[model samples]
Target: MLRRGNEGKKPLKEKIILHYDILFKSHGDDSFDTPTFWEEFFLLKAHPDYIEKKFESFVAKDLIQMKDRLNFLFEKCLEYIQCDQPVRVINALQTMSCLFRGIHSVEVGDHGFDKINLLVGFDMAETSMQVLLRCLTAGLTNDHYNTTIKAVILQLLLVIATGTDNISQNTFVEYLMTNEELYDTLLELLTDPVARSRLGNDTVLLLALMVNYRKYEGVNPFVMRLSVLDDELALSCLGSVISSAFASFNKQFVSKQEESKSSGLFSTITNMVGSMFIGDSDEQKQMIKSNEAILLALYEAIHLNRNFISVLTHSHTDATLVGTPPHTPGGTDDESVPSQPATPTPESFVDASTTRNVLSTFLQYTSVVMQDTKLKRNISSTKLCFIILTCITEDQFANSFIHDENMSFQVCIHKMPMRHRKVKAIVEKPGAPLACWLLDLTVEFIVSHMMKDLPFSQHMRCLGIIHRLMCHEKKCQIRLSYNWRELWTALINLIKFILSNESAIFGRWKKGIFALFTLVINIFNMFITFGDTFLPTPTSYDELYYEIIRLHQVFHSLENFVLRHNANPEYKDVSSRLASSMVNVLAIVRHFNPKIEQYMKDNNMASLTEEEVLEIVKSNYDDLTLKLQHSLDHFERYSERPKETHFFTELVRSISEQYRKTMVFDNIDLQDFMHF
Candidate 1:
């Protein structure tokens, strides 16, 4: 057996000599033991240089001394990989995978250029390219190898493509460009559902990394390949990546620590260390980080691949005509006159299951992010989610998904200040349309960040989404007519909250505030246009009228702020849009002037003129600010409190007791220890 750090008590030089001698002898033996060979290969793969683990010599000198031996081992590994023995090939692939990982590590660290030359001296990049091509040609197509072997071969190629330095990656890409068969086979293997399902996340991640690499220059091969990918295949890949991302979040969010069955102190310490290391392992952290890369791949595909978007927007087509008669209009059936077939009516559609699945996943992910304090800081994923929404919703058919009524989204918003303050949960009803849930979540997300003094461009994107939805009168009518109360309340409160806080108002805030008013006015104008259809009942008429009056009052309050910044060239564009939207509202009010006068008189609700409305807002501004501060502080109470863990406290106390027994402390140290 190969030894690490001279476990068998042999001299370092002697051990190195014996290690090579044994490997060569094993290669010669016809009855080769695969597991034994793997164990020995693993030792060499783990520490290629003899002195790396022991740190007995300077790293550069050790690498220089071991260069020839390392070269010999690589040659042997290549030989084994090309041989007829399947098990031996698999082991060799694993060794190469580990070696490439080490190369990537060297490339990532400081002084990587020099060390990379030493690790993979001359022509190693070319050899890696050849190996990848050979494996793809033989293993991917041959029935001799099972799924596991094919997976290992794919993994080896992935490691070479991703983990190696620029030279190795460029070499592989050049090979792919020239070798059409290899490139085609690789794509076929990746797109195969059976293979992908068996291959798991590594396969998905490898595809994502390859696609995502186009952000760099000289990625024409990948870009060209992405363009040629079948639309269904690309959509499938995107759906898989999104589902994987959601699963990553769900795994962390849904998991809870289990109660320990043992109570011994040693067991406790062991479990604590295991939890610190194994539970929250590097693998878990890597999985979490991969979500960004995966989402980026989806983003790049949506942006770069036109076929992907086409498939996403229109999933399938119906080729048959709806009503093609057996004969011409003037001919009898017995005559059987031949007529040209009616053109197929193509209706825009997407996979409803896929769309619903995506919406539901986002709902759950956003809910978890809001409810879990630990997850609130994950803004990158959240922003990515919104940007993806913005990109897909640009299409009218896709935008109409917000009004999908087949599935309902429900999530519980937890109250902040759990211990001291009593706050009721915001329980969403099960029957509300999906649009209502999305709007509520978006508003809450904006407010949550505003409270934390963190504003982002995604907030603008959120507003743009709502604005786009309102641009279509049919969408606006549905949003208003169904669950009108909640929708109106959310929009009004958001506008009021923004107006109340002048301290947090910046350039973006000005744009956001005006843009919000523009959206509200457009909705108001549409409500009046469709009032007969939307407000058939008298009570509905009263509700909408009251809301319009309240909104008019709000518009009065915002008039001065708009005028103050009207000519500020910075907000000139949004200010003009707001002005035009308000004009539409004025036209609507002009048409209904007599009804407005009679309604106010009948309800005894005096009309507040612009001047009076502004005065009232000024007087109530302080109270509005106070209420906003209270809400922010209420959440802060939960976040600001120090988290107390009994196990951690006891563990620290135990460590302190042991330290105190071993080392006598002076008064200063003793006092500090006591406090700790």
Candidate 2:
């Protein structure tokens, strides 16, 4: 019995010491003849039966004896990797990666992996990183050993990155930061096609861990270096880095099933991208100052990936109508010809659904950036906003984005105030400021696009966005003082064009008319509520009066159109609502008119009668009259359609009752006007 127990214990104890000696006793000068020995040893260590039975006991007993062995092994592996024998080098790397994985898998309860502190405490983490960096550089430069060696190198790098203690992670980060060549080499490798395909996500995670370590340690060497790079190189580097990160995020997190691993991967990528702009120093601010192209590239990458996610999640089908000729009024299908199946064209990345998602994602990212107070003050941030303005204002994106009421255009509008505060602070600077430019661009887009020929829904959307801007207190305050004249002129022209076009007034464009009315009301309310800021100078009173007169004529034309259409059941509610809007317009004009007349009287033109005033405004008054007459004539042809003549009876009676109560209209019969 004693001899059997000794025999059984002898081999187990010998095997443990043999593994420890191979790991620790190896040195850089050792011969490469033992490559198979190390490979076989790692293969034995990876076996399930050995792990389940002997691995824990072996580690608990031999881990202390193997003190600093990982460091020596890392050095020996590096030496072998640099040797001329390809087989020895590959085997050395595979053995190194498997050993690291095995060490990382040994867990002690609540203490994390047991052997990670060996590398970190001995200050060997940097050496491991150097080896991994060398492998990455090699994989990138030599295409012959790309896939096999590169993948194993990445696995080793990730094991060190994610499976180590925080001190070890920081030590690795320090190596990456202090070696600029290594940093740039890693980025170059990331952009390389072969390296990216084999090791993109792992590289991204490593980069993220470095950034996060810097954050925790409060030493931002990488970001500091990024700040001082030449503009072109900096932009190129950022573009490549962010594009690769976005690709990884799309593949692992957005396109795949949402597992915990993928979620962690996405979080790391996000942290990496965000770390670039997170610092508060002037250098960090300068990193984003003039790099509009870089920021735009990042934004577009996220936008594209977001679109990919939407496509993957949504169910999309395409139906094509092919090989079918138009039929005559009484034609039937021919019996002799066989019909062919309509083949559906494959959906592409730029399909309508994807395009819509691209727009949505663009807006969402724009909103996020705008709301980030850290970035809000950066010039590049403003430029990013300018890019978004340019996109949404363009005919293609705008026309498509606005027609979908389900879109978040309104949500973006609501977030403009955050941007408004930032832009307001810098509005008066010498160069073209973003806030002023965006406001001017918005006006230009509205005037150029919201025409009579456009669809009513499109027009309504354009007007709705404008209404939101007009109602935004900050935008109104700034715009009312800076670009109010240009904005007012463009809006007046739009209103005149809409009122003059009979189709706009009476066709299926009631929503558009209502939107236009709401925009005008908001503008007028801004002028009224902010009287101290918006009041015209005494010298400008005549121009203001002329504007009020033009508005009065517009309101009168609108009132007449509503009265004519009030008898049509289709237009009954719309006409009534518009009539009420007209009453509000009249009241606004009435309140401002007396004040303007008093100014005119106090200035010089007290003797001008109503006829004189009409003569002075003859050109605009004639224009208004001609438009109203044309609309009335157009409606006269449609007058024979079924009408509820009593639609306006209550409306007219209310007006007469108010007039009788306020004024001495002697011998007036309200019933006469109520009959319509």
All models: lDDT? 0.48, 0.42
Per-residue accuracy of model 2 over 85-144 as CA lDDT, tens digit each: 445555455555545545554553345323545533346555656665666566445545
lDDT of 1 by residue, 1-676 (tens): 8556756784555543355344333134432235565445533322233322222322445445555444555666676777775545665666555454444443233544444444455657456556657766677655555455666677666655554323223333344454455555555554554444444445554455454332244555665777677757646645554554554454344332222223357635654443312124444444444455455555556655655654433221111111222322112222222233355332222222333344445455554444322332235455556666566555555555556565454443322222323333234455544566666666556444444242435556666555555444243454333545555655655656666675576444657667656755555555544544534354554455455455665655556567777899988888876776565444433334445566568768788564443333334323221111111101111110133233223322332222222221111111211211
After superposition, the stretches of candidate 1 with alpha carbons farther than 4 Å from their true spots are 1-71, 107-124, 136-142, 164-194, 216-219, 231-241, 244-288, 305-356, 366-377, 400-437, 447-449, 472-481, 507-545, 551-553, 566-676
Clashes of each: 0, 0
Give the poorly placed runs of model 2, Cα more than 4 Å off: 1-36, 39-62, 68-76, 84-91, 98-117, 120-136, 164-170, 197-201, 216-218, 231-676
TM-score of each: 0.61, 0.36
Q: CA shift at 88, candidate 2, in angstroms?
A: 5.0
What TM value does model 2 have?
0.36
